[model samples]
Target chain A: MKNGRDPVIVGLADSALEGGRFVKQASVLGHCALVANEALKEAGLSMKDVDGLLTAGMWGVPGPGQLNTVTLGEYLGIMPMFVDGTNIGGSAFEAHVAHAAMALREGYCEVALIVYGSDQKSLRSRTLGGRPSVLNMQHETPYGMLTPVGGYAMAARRHMHEYGTKSEHLAEIAVAARKWAQLNPAATRQDDMSIDDVMDSMMISDPLHLLDCCLVTDGAGAIVMTTAERAKDLKTTPVSVKGYGESHSHWAISEMPDLAHLLPAAKAAKRAMEMAGVKHSDIDVTQIYDSFTITVLLSLEALGFCKPGEGGAFVSDGRIAPGGEFALNTSGGGLSALHPGMFGMFLLIEATRQLRGDCGARQVKGAETALVHGTGGTLSSGATVILQKGLQA
Target chain B: MSYDNPLPVIDQDSAPYWEAARQGRLDIPLCADCGKHHFYPRTVCPHCFSDKLSFDTVSGRGTVHSFTISRRPAGPGFADEVPYVVALIDLQEGPRMMSRIETDDVESVQIGSSVEVIFVRATDEVTFPYFKLT
Candidate 1:
């Protein structure tokens, strides 16, 4: 049974590896625990202080033999009064923050923990992008259609056909992210990347060069949240959760309603910015999830940073790079930094890091407010969160 | 290693559509209530969500809404078909479906290209509705 708990923001921590290097043969639960313990330590509290637990679950349908919330709770050795196994693919963790915030505000539980870890690259596991199965594969799978790149390519192709967005427009996003990566030591790729280098890379899918795709690195990220009052008494400065919102339009790429429009982020970002009482220009820094180059472009357009078809032009010629107006993806994002399958958790961790002034070299200067957006399920789901440096009255 | 291509599983609502594809015809769900057509043949009308639906044969003509040239195979099953073209086909009857665009050269297919559907039997389990430039 559980009792009273306060609403506050306290600790934030990621896994041991800040970048692409990962522990081979590592279990998922081990990754989850490692980060949760690190977060608990950072909060100046022990595991016993955590009365509530929420984790981004395995991205799939739950059946007889799947990882359920109760199973994960038991694995973590925490008997929480409240639990959520909401799996919205990459955007799951951002949604978890909103859920955790509600739980904390309503006094469901205090000291809640959200964690995500994936061992895709090291183990070469097929948790995703595996051979089709009866229950797992979509109808389009039999037609030589598999992998997320194909679906994302379809959207990019549509955006090109409709808006005349060139591959160079997409290339700029990859360039900016790689430039950010160069400043961060922990980032996976260390090459001096350029837009030409991006264009020179092999085409994985038409219009989307190899550079446009994200690395399948194995990693984990976690964050702890308590009430603002409780957070103030803690060790490190609490990164206040100003506002968050999440929404999804469809599950598959083929069913995205319109290829040119990214409605999930449009709707979710609107709700989040409304709740935060901040306009587009007020955002000091943004950690837009860069699962793919087009993902960032579509997100920017959908979130109203640019007009509908002007995302390409907006990122042109050193716009979103290191000293660009947006100060976007300061952690190099999933592109040049790390992408361990579910990337929503990493966005929160990065946003919190920027707000805390903990990000050393690649940190945005005097970064007060940061917006994190995560797109999931082949541009199907979108989640947004705004984190501020100091607590607001 | 006896490998097999991943085939589409026939479900309750989509069973009739796949069966029709096996017979070299493109049948889509048409809702009598809304008087509109929908793709990926389902039990309920996507427009009105009405159960009053039936599979009807169509002209199988559509224009390419968008497309991609997969320089790499999508998965293990598509390894042989590298550099394939997949397109989102806007049906003449007013619905869109995802299918492969069969072309000798990728340059021939683009947005708004007139395409017609043709059933290409992948395996005994299922036949796919492939589109080709008209």
Candidate 2:
């Protein structure tokens, strides 16, 4: 916390997933309000206290001319000082946190709320059937390579070819995650599974098993941020934003120059460490996105937590399991956890909980420092944030 | 077999890929100045950003860099084609292309297996490029 710029996350909340009420329970506008209200309640603040609102681009919904800040402010009867709608795939939430922090540091906003809620799992058939307008669908969707799984499959295929990575190794990641899910009450897939189970599961795309992909969930999450000076008086213990980094390698997987190396994550991780003045070993827990098991493996290598091409081996050896050298995705990750619209917020929530010692069975002991990484758009973009306790500015 | 539907559409950016498919050739964009080859058929050279590029028809010959036997069909259009192989073939000329394994069974598509390009006409405007075990 230096430079009078430390921003602290003071409040967080997520919606429940009961009654199969994914998308229909609340209109898209209502869903945003529902989660936003929960977050405000947790922070002991009224909507009038908010000065900024940030939201991810709605995945399957119509665009709101006014970004989330404007729309939410319009509903809450308060004008926001700043509004941001920077969309970067699942990592949108992480990117929003970084953007809000910068905005606060620049004295643009005294308080900011970053939120994401989606009804992807509950969308009508029409919304799910057509090509997304925001995507470069014209170029990549044809030839039956239209889905996210297809893009990640190509990446996994190349990784296997170049490094001799085994399918069993990928299965190891799914099996381990499922095992962790058994202890997570909120996990969607809590049944016992083994490597063979993953290998035997139906394949969605080549090299991408059904278990390898993330769950389609309907939920929303919000994070409240304020300057460190203001966060001291807040009800909750503030989780300080120690360091952050972000980079976009390409707009599409086909545009990525090297599948063997996830350069963006590497560069972003380096900058994050530099900004935090901490090393990789100092991190007690990590919540890297798991859109696919390969994502986690690749991120481990890119983040310098493990060597290149050793991701497969590193994960298979139980290095990321609970009580291992480093704990990863203790909330079961998107693979087994509920994946709201923007999965990145779930990573942030898990990281914050771990640093605050909120996770019950999956908590890493004495977890003082946490790393959260999010991958967006077919590994085309990535963002990393470091969080620590007692560092509030 | 069930009733057939119209083939998937191929846009301008990917049109050349389909054109090369019909000729039973695997063509990649090669930078004339840099002598570098790239995939996904971009008009400009990724390395030098030179628009001076040409479609170089290479020997469909390549080693299976990595491959996966998809047990489930990717889409309704491919439901009958379950347990198929999709592979990333590393061309000897330097480029990786995603194509299906043109084999009777999945077991035939193995890592490092030698493959040759083949074409299956999908419609008037779309033709899929596939690889067969050599």
Candidate 3:
């Protein structure tokens, strides 16, 4: 490690997942404790040894889910010195990692545990509707824009209009994700799918087919972070957190500054890569949040992998597929793996696993550097983190 | 057909915007300092920190920046209106707003097409400013 103060992820684990469903059915907090204990165990530490806690979920707001860290800490019986219960949407965990890095670097906490759990599929709590028609949502819900999906669809349509992108380009992303998922035993949708399959799939929103969306499943993930010196003595090889940045532009999709251009992602990625002192070419693998196919495309462009309006071409010709030049969403991504509700936590887990060479068939060969970006709240929030194998002196 | 759609929940800051819609007018908050317009009404100027803001009527004209056809209804309230067109309108006044684009053929709605706001009284308390192709 370069410095004793450098923050590195020492442990990562997800709850018992079978066909993308939580095998050990438990409450949100129960799953939280389950994944937390597993991840801590991987780090050769227990919850009692943790001094910091970070968590987020869509369990039950205005109720138990309120003050998530307090509820989780109480459930896990750990009173921490640092706590963050930021609920920015699916990408909250990525933001948490960014915050945890700062805390670990500053010695605010000795051991930081970030956890997320959701039972949206098991409970069938996932809704195809928009948010409540109140406050900022009032302007959107009344018009019946199928939240999340509709926002992404509108962006896809605009992207096509501006850059001559095709639905086929978007389909290639879904097809590619499925190919990766087929190799992942934990992936929920491992069935073979082609571009035509995505095109023929039912349309949830125009310009976005059912296959273009991510899977809805029940899952939970947790990660443990500490200073490089402490992580060096942990159970597993630590993946150093080289750089990270988080930002949000809007809550309502209508408020997005630019549909064609993901400004927040560009800003976050620029800062993270700049801090890591790496260029786009130096990134060996990328695990971007795929809330929608368009999200991956837009994120690739914003992350500097390709030029804006060039994402359509960047992802074409199966370049991002298994045998392709670029390795993206190797854990199958949210598109084909599992999207319980918030998927940012899983991105971190998979990115860490890849860097540790824990993945079997789906591993990117000699992957030393990985870029993980998460898009939450209908492209309203973007968080980018840069990770690398082996600590730098 | 009977009106069975979700209605906007008006709040204090957005009361005037809805009131203007009820009067068949498209009113939005205009920042006196930045001279910029914002939508879905807010207390502070989004572009500038100045609280010097006032309501002004826009041309009710915009171009469709982007749109999507919801093959599935957004919620139970919109169950009867599947395949609806929700669009982001780039208002002539330079601000963007989200509203449904009503047309006989939903597929005909294209980006860059001109649209004008048309107020639809959902109830005594709610008047939605939907758009129609011009």
What total of clashing residue pairs does each candidate reach? Answer: 5, 1, 0
Better of 1 and 3 by TM-score: 3
Candidates 2 and 3 compared: the better one by TM-score is 3
Error of 1 at A50 (Å): 1.4
Best by lDDT: 3
Give the C-alpha interface root-mean-square deviation per candidate.
2.5, 4.7, 1.0
| Model 1: docking quality category | medium
Model 2, C-alpha of A79: deviation from truth (Å): 4.2
Model 2 lDDT tens row, A1-393:
455557888888877775224533776667777777778778787677889888875643355533555665676677787888887888877788888989988999988988787776676321212343222343333334435676677678778877888878887777777767777777777878878788887777777888787777777788888888787677877788878888988765546767767888888888888988889889988988898888888888899988888888888766666556668888888888787546999899888888888888887889888889999977987898989875544
> What TM-score, to 2 decimals, does candidate 2 have?
0.87
lDDT of 1 by residue, A1-393 (tens): 011243445776666553465743457777777788888888797788888777765532345116556666777788998778787889988898888988888888778888887776765764324435342244666656546777788889889877899989999999899888888777888688888899999988777888998888878777888887677667878777778899988764567888888898988999999988899888888988888999999999999999999999999988999887779988788898888888888888888888888889888889888899998888989999988886676
Q: For candidate 1, lDDT tens digit of each residue in B1-134? A: 33456677777878888889899999988999999998777777779999999999999999998778878765665777778897888999998888889989998888899999888876775788898999
What's each prediction's TM-score? 0.95, 0.87, 0.98
Which DockQ values do the candidates obtain, in the order shown?
A: 0.61, 0.27, 0.88
lDDT, model 1: 0.81
lDDT of 3 by residue, B37-59 (tens): 99879989988878899999999
Docking class for candidate 3: high
Q: Give the B-chain TM-score of model 3.
A: 0.94
Model 3 CA deviation exceeding 4 Å by range: B1-3
lDDT of 2 by residue, B8-125 (tens): 4555655676687776777778898999988767777778999988888888788876666655544566567666676667778877666667788777676779988778776655
- Model 2 residue runs over 4 Å out of place are A19-24, A60-79, A124-140, A157-164, B1-28, B54-60
